[model samples]
Target chain A: MGTRQRIVVAGGSLAGHSAVTELVGLVPEAEIVWVTGEPHKTYSKPALSKEFMQARNELAELTLPDVAGDRPRGLRILRGRSCVSLDASGRAVTLDDGERIDFDQLLVATGAAARMPGMLRGVDGVFPLRTLDDAVAIRARLADRPKVAVVGGGLIGCELAASVRAFGLDVTIVERLDTLLDRPFGGALGSYFLDLHRANGVELVMGAMVERVALEEGRVAGVHLADGTEIAAGLVLVGAGSEPCTQWLDGSGLQVGDGVLCDAHLATSSPGIFAAGDVARWTNPIYGLRMRVEHWTNASAQGRAAARNMVALATGRQDLRKAFADVPYFWSDQYGQKIQMVGWHEGHDRVELDRSGDVPGPLARFYRNGRLIAAAGVNAPRVVMRLRRQIEDEARAAEAA
Target chain B: MKIIVDRQRCDGNGVCMGIAPEVFDVDDDLYLHVAETIPEDPELRARVRQSITSCPILALKLVEE
Candidate 1:
């Protein structure tokens, strides 16, 4: 064995892609194996529901530029293959095809899958826009100009609803929650989101549960809500939510909750194993809370941080490992308006609303014990982003204190 | 290094500004303003490259001289 050091990275999305690129640069002497389940190169998933769904971006345009500046000599990329199981003690991962690859260190960034209700499972016109294939299928259906019924008014559902409305198709959003983006915005921008959708000619069905997906001739015909209403939608788009892809690590002796549980350093229970992206629920030092962020920035930043730590552990340079600290941030583009949110707002108590034109748009700041914890705004990139930096500074000061 | 932005595709998320504020700034009008010349600092330049790649809309492009 020529200086045996091997690192295994699973998943092909942004997190895994970023991790592999960093590892390639950091561990020039170690063997790196990347198990990318998707055959295509890494692309931006956020564009799927917006640009790609609206056909504003071509299929080839969504591909992310390669970040692996200088490819390592011992790097191997296994495309179109997935991890089936893992043996933590044995330090090996079994592929879907029963091949076992031993690793000195492992990084799990499998991401998440869109949740589909059982009633919508076999319906032909039902779609979920989590993956590229799903977006392609939904785009194909959109060419038919079918009445769209969007399930859940979360980020994906709201964005897709706006995109579908842009096509002049009748769109009805069925959300169990009363408001749009309540969790992310922390109910601070209460009626702003709702009014935006309404102003865009989107049909909002609030506090309604999708009881079933009406089918005709093995295809989605409409949507049935628990409120005793039947919406005549030719096709149904389910943006219900997502579940982290952790079924493969079921018996791997790793702590797996809603996601792969890890520490602030993103290290899993196993010494050489770590997790990041939507598949990781780790303790965030900023808020002192365990969070599983599906946001793109968290995945991108955490992937790079976890890769450095993994290299340190694999090379026996443990002192070089550092804790990953980040104030989560994400933005949404809907009907020509930009919605941005920064910092964690789960436990915020007081919220201050600012529509006095101090900012470029309607903005709200969340607070706990008079500390700025989170802020959300519409079309206010400069002010909102500045608040993000302030939140990071406050967090740093608090940590030092 | 020179920075170019695709204004047509830029939604002005300010992700680049969050990474390297010295080189990227978005105004109140949600217009992204890139620095005319990026200083030749190795660490800052690396971050600028990361910021370019991190743009949610992929609107930023870097040209090295």
Candidate 2:
């Protein structure tokens, strides 16, 4: 056994790429192999939903760090290689190409795949956006000025529906819930957002269940609502939700719940192995809960934290510590209004609307559990900024006081 | 030196343009952009580097040449 360690990073996305960057800084002497399922260089996931939809070749503009400098001495980046399974007992991985690699430390940041519902199967032109390929396909369909139908009126779906309209394509959004952004935003804010989308020429069909998808010539032609009415669409994009990509670890003996279960340090039950990004089910001591976040902020920070801990384990360094709790912050842009959200406003007992700011702009709706738990705003970047710092500081003060 | 934006952390506030006018600007979608990478000019490089540090969202990073 040598002090020089080999670290294997599977899945090259935001979290995987961040781990590569931080590991190089943390363990400069260690050998790191970065494997990605995507053929091109690692890019931002958030852009795949919106900006890339609006422009061509925008994915090429999203390259990060460019860690593979001349010779690429410490890091070896392999594209188009997918890991089939992990052998925790042997600390080895079996690639889809039948290549075997052993590692002293393993970080699984495979993230999640866009979950396609079973009922929507055998329906052509009904797609879910996740990877660059998904974005490219959707972009091509929109270019034809097709009448598009989007299911799941959450952040991504709403943004895409709006983008399609901006590109001069007819758009309609079908949401199962009573309002748009049901889980993330409350009734008032969701209503405001729905109106905004409608004002911009997007048709909103709320509380509608998609019974089945209609296909013609092996391509999606329309979606049949539960009400027995068929809504025609040249293509259907179902952004219902996502599930963690943990099928590779099917019998690996790691504790698997909604995601790969990890302790406070983001470590898997197995030794010498850790997980981060959207796939890791992190336990938050601050809220006394365990959850998986698919946001970029969470993925980036968790990647860096996981890397530091990996280096600590490899070098036998005791000073490096882990365990992080962040006040969940996310942002979305639609109808030319920048919407920012801060904190977890789940199960709020009350909602306070502050319309003191400009009408239809710069409004803040606070969700309170006696005090304040979270806030959602429309065109209110200033309020969102202040609330983020305030909520974080308040959480710290509560811990101390 | 060069500046980097963590596209994840970036809220497209466009405040970076206010700090360093020569190097940074906001695109049509309100996202931040770097007009040029200061590869040779040390003086302009230092200012762009400083703006990266002062970015509120911690979205910017500086790469030294």
Candidate 3:
């Protein structure tokens, strides 16, 4: 049947996996060839920082819909194959093993990977919390009440330290910034969590940078600070941010700004090619902003959107230009508190509401042009819901005007 | 016609109830709770359908006669 209109998907993480799953649903008759850099079946990315830290086997069980299943009919799964080059001129993708497959349409769901500070290869006790392998390595240190030290006060670091401490491991957080999650929440909410983490018995070392990791007998022994101080720890987890997986696209003739530059519809500059998930630099319609987010919500939504748009482009249906306007939301479980944020409030000119007065519910900080642009809460899902509606209302008014 | 929502897709954003409160409301998990008592206004059904169309995840579907 003329090769069934070949569709190829790269990267087998949540975004890659979900995009493949939705693409099969969107075009059942299409021949699917999904390639993943990893050899194993896919699983949920969110569980890695949360649930997978507790155990490793459950990480494989969180697969949304087995991409390797037969319900997708003509879908083909290729594990341990990395797409090293995107040949737009040839209408094919080149694998690392020097195999090329032609496709009618291509979805670049290649997600980002976490940054490992310096070289983690030879560093004793260096760890990063990103993939299942990272978690498995970190879990190995939990034995024998190891003294754990986590660098970077970001969401992953804080959550990982908290979870590690729950296992009664002596854990401490060393952040270069003065507080945790500072970029997302600013220093105010970050300091709040700094206190919470200390109260939970996890030591907090704010405003410190690790100059180097100390090693003895080829094992991580401690971290040496820039100010000539060393903290002893058996395990070290670096929770710094991630870098987009767009290095392979270098000189590929596709414009790469913060991410693969796409318009509202997640379409790349080249025809029959689209990018999404952590690698897609999406424009936020609500506040006229652009960001590349690695959150699960962003990955799934953008993956599904990219899939539909690819289907539309292949089928010659031009109505797939609708952009994602959903408010950015993030959640972090630390120190027994669920910190949730709806909408972007960073660099806000004004702080409209600061409800620290309310201990737990609606304990939020809102910002806008004399309006409420965002809100954060602890056990305040309802308020976050209301704030989401408010942001949507503002977005619609802005579009209409 | 009635609007039905698939709870699994709802992340508790509450966009459905915010646009058309007459037909949809938030449940405990903050997903849409459709009214069983039929509302006479056909326009509310249309609005809910519109909201469903805008949902990033196609969580809402309309059952029409």
Candidate 4:
């Protein structure tokens, strides 16, 4: 056999971990070096909000099954090491400790970091739920179900509120937008969620910007809004959003926008280096648009696609390369209801309630320029499934046209 | 192939039903059930396997009959 090539993967989250697994399966003889900033192995980040808060498993149940288990002979994981710089010209990376490692192929799946508001930057009890450690820290700070104030009414914020409320704690959700989940689900579903949270005893503070975090003895006492209203709370969680983890590649000369811009094949600006997951902003050929998705399903699919492309490039079989395109799918659990969405609904001109027949929730469909673009449903799983297939079919027809 | 679902692990996310409607169904009560105990054909068997793997919670599993 010829000399094996070394493949270095940065960020041991779902995306990087999935890439390493795919690489091992695709090219068994390749030498794999996995670099992760965290100490533990890959775990289900989605489970952090859904499971970690309600029950105190300490993240034992959230770990991804066998991601860091037995290796495939040439696989080595460098845990607790972060990539500080990338030398694209030299095809290498400098770790936080200044150790430079050369690679035949590099996959940057650094994922994203939780976005914290400027006012609450150094405030204690202001937690962002992104990693296992974040979840653990938040849980440790919650003592005896103190009043919990969650900033941002997005998916993570709502889910976290729902999970913590299940512990019989008084929870409040503060959102800057007029309605919750309006960007993706639109007004109808957003109002529905507003009602759901209210019905479940969750206080909603909408259309108000948080001015600053109230501090008492160097800890979070509550949040003060711009309108001079203050909500008292013992703990605060800021789930505003997430930004791509690409600051380490500042001078790498790669096309960095909201994320690392990549082609349809998940290849970055630099050759032999690819990106996947939330950090990868690629133009999806299927949707005929560019988007950077933070969904778990997208991360898994992109990770596998990036790994296959890397293997093809290394084996000198460029002809066998495939484009990365999958319909985006995500699910959030809140208030005993399962919210599922398939396809992109942004910029849709019309949204219609397709079904509301006492199925506990409604199924909504979004259309753009007379073309079905997306669909979302609450507790109507089968309808959402059928709509996803329809969206896939429509996307294929559009691609063909 | 025989289909099995771990009810404790299944959160009724509907991922399985979305992948294979013939084999899995999530009711309005947010409960997952096997619509078809056995896949009628080879194509359906493939889809059931896909559903099993697509389940985010890893609640669904396939067993050889």
Residue pairs clashing, model 2: A124-A220
Give per-residue CA lDDT, model 4, range A1-401, as digits (tens): 13779899999987887788778877878888899888887877887888777773446556665543476788888998999999998888999999998898999999999998788787788899998888888887775567999999998899999998888899999999989987656565877888889999999999998999888999889999999999998899988899999999999878899999999999999999999999999988868888999988788778878998998898977854899877788989887788988888887899888554755577788898888888888877777777788888888898788
Best by DockQ: 1
- Residue-wise lDDT of candidate 3 within A16-123, one digit each (tens)? 776787687667888989988877677666656665675533643454446535556878888889999887767888899999889888888788888887744458
Residue lDDT tens for model 1, A1-401: 24669889999899998898888777777898999998888898888999888899876778888656535587888989999999999999999999999988899999999998898887888888899999998998989999999998988999999999989999999989889988778887759989999999999999999888777887778988888899998888988789999999999999999999999999999988999999999999988899999988888888988998988776768865889888888999899898999999988889999999877679999898888999999888888888998998898888898
Superposed on the true interface residues, model 3 gives a C-alpha RMSD in angstroms of: 6.3
Tell me the tens digit of each residue's lDDT in model 2 across A1-401: 46668899998987887778778767778889888878877776676676677773365556654653433567887788988899999898889899998888899999999888897765667778888788888887777788999999987798788778778788889999878977766555876887788889998899999998888888888999999989999989888889999999999888889899988888899988999999999886545468788877677667877888887777778666667676666677686687767767666677777777553364554555455667777665555656665776767776687
Relative to the true structure, candidate 2 reaches a TM of 0.86
Ranking by lDDT: 1, 4, 2, 3
Query: Per-model i-RMS in Å?
Result: 1.3, 7.1, 6.3, 2.0
- Tell how far residue A46 is off in model 2, in angstroms: 1.3
For candidate 4, what is the recovered fraction of reference interface contacts? 0.49
Give candidate 3 misplaced runs (Cα > 4 Å). Answer: A1-3, A68-71, A119-121, A318-321, A356-362, B1-65
Q: Is candidate 1 or candidate 3 better by lDDT?
A: 1
Among residues 3 or more apart in sequence or in different chains, the pairs in candidate 3 whose N, CA or C atoms overlap within 3 Å are A124-A220
The model with the greatest TM-score is 1
What DockQ results do all the predictions give, each relative to the true complex? 0.69, 0.11, 0.11, 0.49
How close is each model in CA RMSD to the real structure?
1.5, 5.1, 5.1, 2.8
Fnat for model 3 comes to 0.03
True contacts kept of each: 0.54, 0.00, 0.03, 0.49
